[model samples]
Target: MYARLFPIIAVLAALLAPAAAASDLTVFAAASMREAMERIASGFEEETGTKVVFSFAGTGVLARQIEAGAPADLFVSADADWMDYVTENGSIDAASVRQVASNALVLVGASGAAALELEASKIADFLDDQRMAMADPDTVPAGRYGRTALENLGLWQSVAGRLAPMENVRIALASVARGDTPLGLVYRTDAEIEPNVAVLATFPDTSHPEIRYLAALTEGSGNPAAEPFLDYLTGPDAREILQSLGFVTDKVE
Candidate 1:
């Protein structure tokens, strides 16, 4: 009787030990990905019976944080450039990097603003009294793409004085949505989140660099749960969610 009871108690303890030791994985992602990624992470947590913690900001800032020893299990960057930065620095596995989603750059404006037909060449005309908002091009990929589009359309130099640089694309979108800035360049998904804003125009493919969303597991993450989350982001369910939020499914070139 003693032997049988002892074996049963040891098995129960073994089972409880793993449950108690299970860790919450930390994911650092770009500000633009916050809405969709949070939903996906919530679903992942429910399905896997694990906890997920997130930190969202500009990809450049997140990369710098990770380089400075921020404890993160996974990273989702707004573009390939910052993903490359972490990979090159040996902070994450290069082979684990995958393009998760793509986004189109769009010009947005307050819903109550004048209805203007925006063509690539006519973008500057829309910026007359309206301040145009964008993320800081020096630290945000979306801002760099917006700048490139403006330059390609011969509007960047002319509109330089009319620009409001936000910390991230999400903030730039917020400025337009709140009517603080009448116009902004942001991801199409960001515009979708704001009922007060209207997408005035999408940048022509030839007008700017393609925007790609990339993700990878961090190098020193002790959490083995990171891989599954990365895999889930590329799965059908996650893709469907992303599509519903206005993200493009195609990979950026």
Candidate 2:
């Protein structure tokens, strides 16, 4: 009876060993970083045996979730304001925050749409009577960038009522790709991935505040894997992927 019990105990220990040692990481990231983040996380998982899970949404929404005590190991926001929001609310450690990447805004249209130079005066001509798709200007980073760009170009008042606001930049990109909207405003990196769309023109950097993506480990993150994952994002491997994807990685400090 003792020998039989020992064998059963050994088998149970073997079966549960992997589960007991496994580590998982949960990351909240801006919707724009979804593709690049996933690719980087895949490598991270392979290297460290940590299972990475992501929650991708607009920066504002993700920050709000983090502030409300969401169980996220990391927070990667599209702009500093949202990151600041979570930090101020005691959701993430301010010292852990770092800018990972930067991007430019662009005007996008259907892939086959005529290639025309877009300027403040010609925005209406490009859209004709149709609407311009953009993220919700009231809160989303992409939308705020778009609104500011238009305002800086003196085009906001002309096209204010013609805006078709989506929940996030990805949806705004889709609206243009699917021809649901005549044009869209999105990050240059977003325009690069959508084969069904074409970048009509890039907005000048002066049109709005600098676009930056910030990453941080959340205050509530208890996973030991979180720190390693955060380091991976700022390390060389992730930098290469981010640059290849059209994100301006020079400011990744």
Candidate 3:
């Protein structure tokens, strides 16, 4: 009886040991950053032995969640505004804020679709009465960029009524991939990952504000591993991974 009980206790201790030593992390990132972050997080986990959990959504939604006391160790936004929103609300450590990546907006459509010139003057003719899928222009960074580009080129007023707003940029990409929408405006990185979607044209950088991605540690985070993970993001490892995923790393590029 004693020998049998010893073996049971040893098994129980072994099962509990990993749980005791594990460093659990909760990272909130923008929907567009999902794929790249997953790859980066896998590397961070392999090296640090920390289980990095993620919550991917629109920057506005994630910012609101952090502001409302969500258990997030880090926050990564697709644009500066949402990060600014959380910072002003005192939800993140302003000093830890870093711009990690950049992306361009592009016009995408179902595979095999005819290519359009991507000029604002000819954009209306390209739509052909079909609604353009995009994230909510009021809140999503990608949508805001698309809207700004259209307005800058005098195309917004003409196509305003034909916009199909999604909850996030990924959904906009999905809409085009699924052939639910004839056209979508999404980050260039998003287009790279979806095989069913064809990139028709890349919006000119001069067409809108520069797209930027920012990452920061949350104020309420007490995790010791959070700093290392955040560091890895701005470090060389993450830059390589992000660049492979079609994100522009560093400001000079």
Candidate 4:
């Protein structure tokens, strides 16, 4: 009886050990992607029987961390520039890099804020005294695009004084949503999640650089689980999840 019980327990442990080990994948992603990525990660874990751990922050900040030898299996950057930084530093696999999604910049105003309208002409009048929030253009891609759009529309020079720089796009969006700033330039997905903000207008494609979200595996991860997650990201199910979240799927482009 003791011998039979011992053999059964050994078999059970062997079956469970691999499942337990597979449940630990570390993913570093952009702060603006937190909400959407978390939801997708949960779904991925459920389907693949893997656990996901995430670190979220500005793409530039995350890139620096990766360059400094942070142990991350995967990276999802808010823009291509930071991903390039990682690849240039030999921190990520250049061949594994892929454009996963696209985001649009939008002017978001506080709920019921009448000072700003979507029209180009009204933007100038709206900028006269109202404070506008933005991320630091030097370190944040969304902010850089915001500045470019303003400069292209001839608003940056006139409204530069009223600009309030935040740490990241999500922070800028929060400022407007919370009424700390009357308006902000943020991703359409960011605006969509904030019920307290109204989208004034989406920046025309010609107004600024195209916003591309890129993903890649970090170098030296060597985790067998990492490739599966990457494959899941490019699969049909993940594309559907991205599309549902207002992210433009690669198929659309």
Listed in order, each prediction's TM-score against the native is 0.86, 0.89, 0.88, 0.85
Instruction: Identify the runs in model 4 with alpha carbons over 4 angstroms from their true place.
Output: 1-23, 114-121, 251-253
The global C-alpha lDDT for each of the candidates, from Candidate 1 onward, is 0.82, 0.86, 0.86, 0.79
Q: TM-score of model 4 relative to the true fold?
A: 0.85
Q: Which candidate is the best by lDDT?
A: 2
Candidates ranked by TM-score: 2, 3, 1, 4
Q: Which window of 10 residues has the lowest lDDT sum in candidate 4?
A: 13-22
**Per-residue lDDT for 1-253 in model 1, tens only?**
6435533543443233322234888888999999899899888989998888887878877887777667788999998888998899999988889889888888899886665554534556776676789998877899999889888977787777888988799999989888788789899889898899998877888887778898999998888888998899998888888999988876622
lDDT, candidate 4, 181-236, per-residue tens: 87798999998888999987778889987888888999968788888888787778
Per-residue lDDT value at 57 in model 3: 80
- How well does model 3 score by local distance difference test? 0.86
- Better by TM-score, candidate 4 or 2: 2
Please provide the root mean square deviation of candidate 1 (C-alpha atoms, Å).
12.9
Model 2: per-residue Cα lDDT over 1-253, one tens digit each: 6445533543443343333223578888999999999999999989998889887878877776666566788999998888888898898999999989999999899887776564655888888889999998987899998899889988899889999988789999999999899899999999999999998888899999999999999998889999898899999999999999999888788
Lowest summed lDDT across 10 adjacent residues in model 3 is found at 13-22
Which regions of candidate 1 fall more than 4 Å away from where they truly are? 1-22, 114-125
Clashing pairs in 4: 23-51
Task: Give the candidate number with the greatest TM-score.
Answer: 2
